[model samples]
Target: MTLAAPIDPLAGAPGAYRDDLVEVVRTRHVPIGAIRTDSFAFWTDHDRVHLAHDLPAERIDNDLAGLVAAELFAPGWLEGSELFERLMTGLVVSAADDPLSAWTLFYRNTMDRLAQLTSLRPGAATEPHHGALVEGSLAGYAPVYRHAAGLIEPGSVLELGSCFGFFSLFAADRFAMTASDLSANTVRLLGRVAPLLGRRIETVICDAARVPRPDTSYDTVVALHLLEHLPAEHGAAVVTEMQRLARRRVVVAVPFEDEPTAAYGHVRVFTARTLIEIAIASGWSWTVHEHHGGWLVLDRP
Candidate 1:
């Protein structure tokens, strides 16, 4: 099978962690902020999944697809395997080199293919071990994942919009990456993945507007695909927060083509030019580039 379909990273939008796991120590400990675990297996319309699970465990993920179609049609959902496969393939191609995309596709396909039990949403609750694509999101945005297998020396980290704890959990291996998100459900899902990677973290449910700590909280702070969801005011607020939290640098990545519009809950979009201006305003010395998508690296003073 030549990977009949690709994956989607944002398939399920969603959240923490524990301590005493990291074997090597590098940075001084920052005070533990808070923790959350409320989003595990949150509510969704999974009537299709329940119906599919009724058929056979062997073909659960596939059978669910049948149920969803049948319910939407008559007596049961059917005649959809090909269409569903196409959609999955579309998502995979978009994020060719992103594990996050792999994880995303897995959930998207899971729900579309196995709907009898319920609706599928990708995030912290599902499998985190994804495509393991290294160069895509990281190489383009050097401050993070690019060549992550062994490039980072040792430092402190702070992350904005740390959904379900994947990045922070990934960061703990090389740096002191502390992450936070708005949903507690996201944090709970992250808590599960954290232990598996031999890493640990303290996550909190907090708005990006009001960071608990002020400037110099961490050596580096990263904000990825977060600006697109907020209004200009909120997006600007996040920059300030990242700037205040970071002791050394700030990193930001924005989409180029589907630049955020006012109505899509995205306040202001960015160009390499705008990104530089924003970083300067937020007190970061940033370098912007167009790689894979819009990429920016902000170095703090």
Candidate 2:
């Protein structure tokens, strides 16, 4: 049976936008089945799976409709099992593309949706699907951005493991932001997009554990939602590296998850105790607290 079409957030987008998306899907090399796994799933596909397991077939059908409504899957692309496979294949390829142009397209779509959502009149009716897409894209990160912003010290800041550099962009007006990440694609995307967004932020492609900058290079160093993606020892090394790079303070944040959310590529779980242990091991004047997640703030002498 064919699934009903969901609202298209990109319905009126320029022809070029649709062309770009189609090109990305056409050129994708990886198969969807090859990328689907028990442990790691695409964030967009997470609802179809439950705790690292696929939901029952009936549930998945329901979930796929939800995904379509959220704009994670294209409208009318769920008419058959083959189209569903195409949808997943497009998502997997778009995420893994080294140039990251596909990911950029997705980002642009979300931003456009957000703009439309915000332009509505007070008490205006919002399409539930658009609301879901906007919420899924920004809701989790917005509070964390505000929390981290409150803790950051005045002066220059360096953010390690800055995937997509969204936090860096969020705080750019308040700080001299430099966002570094291990992925060249992400760094490149950030460098290209920051100016377009009216933000001035520097981008560096480097490992967080071994940044090339000299000691005391910035007044504040941040590693938000980053440690959980690294091994324990590597995370510790990154903490030490943050100290070496900051003259004033080091800030770290991790989700308080019972188990890592592999869809986001999280490899380990962290709690308040683990954050406190990290602070103690650093031997810095530190404060540990929970906001949306666990945070360890280390003040330098």
Clashes of 2: 0
- TM-score against truth, every candidate: 0.51, 0.64
State the displacement of the C-alpha of residue 273, model 2, in Å, after optimal TM-score superposition: 0.7
Candidate 1 Cα lDDT to native: 0.46
Q: Which candidate is the best by lDDT?
A: 2
The lDDT values for all models are: 0.46, 0.62
Residue pairs in candidate 2 whose N, alpha carbon or C atoms collide under 3 angstroms: none
Candidate 2 lDDT over 1-301, as tens digits, reads 4453431222222211111112122222334553333222332242231111232222221123235323323333223332343343233233323323433454454444444544454335665441253312344455667778889878999999997677787788899999999877558767876777677999889999999999999999999889988998999899999999999999998888887744445689987888888888887899999877889999986
10 residues in a row with least lDDT, candidate 1: 15-24
Give the residue spans of candidate 1 off by over 4 A.
1-144, 147-153, 259-268
Root-mean-square deviation of every model: 17.3, 11.3
